[model samples]
Target chain A: MKGKIRSMAYAARHDGLHAIRPPLMKRIADASAPYLYSAPALILIVAVMLVPLVLGVSYAFRDIQLLNPFSGAFVGLDHFRALSEDQAFFRALRNTLWWTGASVLLQFTFGLILALLLDKPFSGRAIAQALVFLPWAVPSFLAGLNWAWLFNPVVGPLPHWLYRLGLMSQPANILSDPQLAMWGPIVANIWWGIPFFAITLLAALQAIPRDLYEAASIDGAGPVQRFLSITLPFLAPTIAITILLRTVWISNFADLIIVMTNGGPADRTQIVASYIFTQAFKRLDFGYASAIALVLLALLLAYSLLIVILRQWLLSKD
Target chain B: MRAKSTFLTIAHRLAILAYIAFALFPLFWLLKVAVTPNDLLYTEGVRLWPSRASFEHFDFVLRHSSFPVFFRNSLIVSGSTAVIVTVLSSLSGYALSRFRFRGKYWLVTLMLLTQMFPLVMLVAPIFKILSPMGLTNSLTGLVIVYTAFNVPFATFLMQSFFDGIPKDLEEAAMIDGATQFVAFRQIILPLTLPGIAATLGFVFTAAWSELLFSLMLISGNEQATFPVGLLSFVSKFSVDFGQMMAAGVLALIPACLFFLFIQRYLVQGLTAGAVKG
Candidate 1:
């Protein structure tokens, strides 16, 4: 009887071990599964983006002009030195700031109003929402071209309308006038971009709890007062993040400038991004273009870091 | 209070109308010019509607020009990029949503960093890299580049979608003897079809609009995407305003269709993300 009980206990222990081993193996497989899933995307990103980024940085210090067969020599910051003196480069830097600032400000302001307007329930809200958001669907290149045509004196009505409104002396294309040329792209950028802000801000606005608004109204808060206290605070974080991301995005956005002006009518509308393109494509000077790109990259990185640190400081204070 | 509220309501309606008009006016003008006969295009300056409209420009663009080829190329590239990015992003996004692995934070950071930098920086290097491998001027090259560029955002979007799904559904599947991969593929994926559709639409529109790399990489007219072809046509035949506008309208069709399909989901998806964050 003693021997039989001992054998029975051993047999149970053996069965428990068998059950535990498969699960241990399964856990190991499970733990590594996420990495396995992510590996393909990570590999592609590294191969296509990260490797090229590193190579692009290296190209900044070398001469890698596209057309010139003999131009693959290490130049050691020669492109940078020349960039420091290029008047066009300085002008482009200024234009970039102007373009990004104006575009962001207008898009955000109009977008906020639109978002607030749409936030309220009304008849035909669905159709109104779809129609208003259509521009975001238009391809940026096409938007650029379409707007360019609109501003054209020959084929478009904008110039004619402006002349009628006494906004201009004649129905001349503002795109050709160096003085007001940058506004052409800036306006187009705003028209193409407002829907983005509207969509994002509208989403954020909707997420604001309904009870908060009810409570505020119960406390005798008027529309303006409620907007000032409740709406503003709720929209602040979205506004900050959207503005930050858009600043970086718009500064690099060259499609409108390229399509509208080709950085032309005497380089007046040439932001740094278009300038980089002109160097690489028109001049075939990849080395110089990469150099300009590097500086732009560094400035953007600094800007992003500054925003992050500022946010952290504010958070800590609160 | 009654008077003020009524006034506010009127103001709101008018405001919404104004916004809609501002948005649609440009597109309407594009269509207006596209349908205007060649003879009427210049004569009817500033006319809201032309005296007579014709499809002559559209007919000419479809039969006479290389636009058909360009359209086909764009469809191929954008369609492939959308499908491939959705698949890859679904996997990576699943990893992000479900896993607590090492380097996950860094991976997210890397993806965001890609979005913040000027893509023009990579233009030269990509050309150099791809040219050596004979990938430039090829549709394959464009697809690869666009897929990489779009995956980051699509992944984030997909992750939000995945987060909305319950973990128990997959857990129960696992408990029923299905592998996790099978569960993800057969169970969770079908439930997230709307999210998948949204991702597909977003990536499709992005790839469709990409101009610079396509312009740089494709030197041959044979492989030119819609943007490149339209641009080249504009520059070469600057006098054909009607044809160019017609072609522009054609280009707008697919993107608009995709947009209409996804617009309803846009706010919902973003709200999901905003709430989670």
Candidate 2:
């Protein structure tokens, strides 16, 4: 009788174990399948981006002399000290701010204007749209070079014509003038940036329901009144997002300065990017350059995160 | 009702025509300079067309100088970087768009953060890392650097494209005895041709015109890209406008041909499935 009872208990235990095992195995398989999908991309991104970032941050804190890189000493805030006090770095900071602020505002305005103009039905719309978008399609370095050539004092067609036509007393080397040099890059950047805004805003414009406009028209609203009541409100989110993103990008408009000015006329047009280049490559002071980079990075991070947060809030409200 | 709007329509068309002329004038001048004889470049001054036109500058830039070498180098670098970045970004972007993962948020944030830094900052550490690998002063080095810098934004671009695609088609493919990767290649990639074209165009143009890394990495004329080559036109005292503009015009051809080839897909790609993602 005791042997039979013990055998029954053993059989129950084995059945229970078998029943639990399949679900456990299945759960493991299910959870891991998604992970398997994501693992490759995650690994590549980390290898290319995350590792370098962490290394950059760590290197920023260390006092790394090129001559004695192996003997890096941990000097807290020394690099930061050097950057904040540097006159050239400060000029770059100021210039970058102006570049970002002016470019973002004007680009948005022109983009919206162009998008609105294109929104209406017209002949040759496709070709006109393409022509406008051409600047953005070209790489910015090429555009900068083209603009530099256009503004060349002696040989360039634009200035030469102006000089011969007596529009100016002297050949206006726009780049040579401290006041006008920065404008060359500004124009180049604005040209490249406007199309992105135009495309995004145009996409948003197309989404607005026709019924809204119809109803407004029935209420005796003019075209301008309808645009104010209907178009502006609908475009606000896209405009905001576009501005935020553009600000983030235009801040790094270093390539323009590099190709055009090389921060010329005594660092007058130097922005954070060119300044960082000058510090790192020309000066060979990696630590100090890295510090300025950190500051620039911090500015970008704050704006980007703010945008993200704002977007989330807007979405949640929707 | 239709007649009243006809006058307005004609005026609008005329306005657009004017705008088109304004946009294209610069490109016309690039060609104008390319063909203008060197003697006529300055002597004719502001004249729209020179009395004489020749291919002397073009011939000189192409034959007597390093322009062809620069062009070839640019082609190799831009072509390789575009292909490499597009392939990588497509796969990674697909993963990001479709799969829910443990670290997706942080991974994306980190990629954005990488873009946030002025690339000038990364140039030092990049040089440090690539120096040991002997990647500096080579086409491979430029390709690698361009690929690294471009991937994040390319990934974002491609992810947006992938997101625009319907997931049901892929799911149906999976149900019909296809693996995920196979489905991606056979079904999804065909639909992504426009996206692929846009990505290729963007990356190609970017790497083609990049000057900073080229200026830094390459020291010799043989390895120089076009932008750097254009700089050689500038000696200490005088700038060679004819040769430089001639070179610039030649550079514009590949880029123009590239844009012409991709422009159709680029337009469709930008406006594709707007109401969706």
Candidate 3:
């Protein structure tokens, strides 16, 4: 970063704006190269995404319903007021916590194990790695549908198998049972998401110096001791960053819940993300939806800040 | 110690096999159901393989369903989005990699900020904005939205690739009587062919999987992408497990094919974007 800055100032002094010998046309062309390269992408993002995001934030302070033609009224805090008392929204918030917590925890644990397993130089490990990572390629909606089918009693084997194993009293669709509905999507998410953690953690694991482990072993360190003293410390930054980012990312991920349950069976699967979809699309209440989204955005930012502070604190302790 | 090491090796292999089975089982079920004739779908429901399997479901979906249309629409949308995003991101990513220009910091920050926020927030507003311009309920609209959504991460992915190549290659070309732009085009972009392919495949899969906006923006059956089409078919038809599973398998084909091709570089791509969900 400092090198880039130094070069910028150097170019400015020697060959850029301060130089007098260069022709006007040549200088202009030289200065505008990066702009010309980047303008197309920047303009599209501004027009499509960034502009809409600002508008969406503004929508939180107004009354905007899709079907109601005369509904663009300025209603300050009315949406937020309604959101505070909405039991369903509160329920969705709690569900978001449960969903993000369980999904990240399980995905990380299994992913670390999978990475550790693959780290060894074993025969046919390449094919094994590919096969195990295949689930991450399955689109989120299909993952939901596939798992939802598995939970269905008639066509799927899961319910019957669980029944045979005496885990369930009968073959049933857990998706329609409010108490157990969230697990349906949560399980699908774990299946789809495990590969992500595995791939990334594997990359980090491979980058760890092999000699460090050799040295630790030669120093009479056992497997668990070496893992704690070497692997854990080596992998800590990657683990922290991945965990923090995945938390926010998964909380915003609503496709599995939306496809599987649509927040049904008494809204058991209604996280804030799917709730935003439900409000904006189903109810056509853009205002309320944007308000909920604003709250979610704030929460995610706060969470990210918290993680950054926690990371800094841990680093300072060492 | 030898006996314990031998047991650990067996356990490790068993664990790998177990994970592979768990990963492939759901996909296997999708294929199994797709090939199973409707009559035996329920009778052989819990069986690992259907007693009688046929391509009747795929046949019916291809010959006599709206799926062909959905498949074509998905191809067009995802393909266009991927190509367009690759082109745009390549340019921006090149700038990010090679330049020390003004406002570069802000530009990078803007792109990163876009990656972090909830895109569901933009649904209603984008609809409102696009509808007035008559872009809603159109494939062109879907393509534009998808292209924009993908460009930021694709840019980062492309930038990482550019970063890997030494700047001296382009500089050497520039000093040998070639302009910087010409050198970048003739000498540098060719070397990043693998990165470009990886970016294209990555963006294509992302555009293919998008659901919410497509559902919202494209209201009619004619413009529906695969996700919207398959979803509506599921809700409307309600019980054609054979056909739905067949279509699901078809939807899986393109993404998985591209996935297999680019699986090796996923560490780079995911690290760049921090894993888009």
**TM-score of each predicted structure versus truth:** 0.93, 0.87, 0.94
lDDT of each: 0.90, 0.74, 0.90
Ranking, TM-score, top scorer first: 3, 1, 2
List the candidate 3 regions with Cα displacement exceeding 4 Å. Answer: A1-27, A305-318
TM-score of 2: 0.87
Task: Encode model 2's per-residue lDDT on B1-277: one tens digit a residue.
Answer: 6886897777767766664665566666667767888777777876778898888888887889888988898888999999988888888778788888776777666666665556666766776666778887788888877887777777777887888899999999989998778899899989988888888886787777677777767767877887777665544224566677777777777777677666655534343211100
Candidate 3, A1-318: lDDT as tens digits: 999999989987777654566577687888899999999999999999888988999999999998999999999999999999999999999999999999999999999999999999998998899899988878788898999988989788899998999998988888998889889999999999999999999998999999998998999999999999998898998898899889888998999999999998898889999999999989999998999999998988777667546645764777
lDDT of 1 by residue, B69-155 (tens): 999999999999999999999999999998898888788768877777889888899999999898999999999999999888888
What level of docking quality does candidate 2 show? acceptable
Interface quality of candidate 3 as DockQ = 0.72
Residue A79's lDDT within candidate 2 is 84
- Tell me which of candidates 2 and 3 scores higher on lDDT: 3
Docking class of 3: medium
> lDDT tens digits, residues A113-138, model 1?
99999999998999999999999889
Just chain B of model 3: what TM-score?
0.98
Stretches > 4 Å off in candidate 1: A1-27, A306-318, B268-277
Residue B145 in model 3: lDDT: 97
Isolated chain A TM-score, each model: 0.89, 0.89, 0.89
What is candidate 2's CA lDDT for residue B55?
82
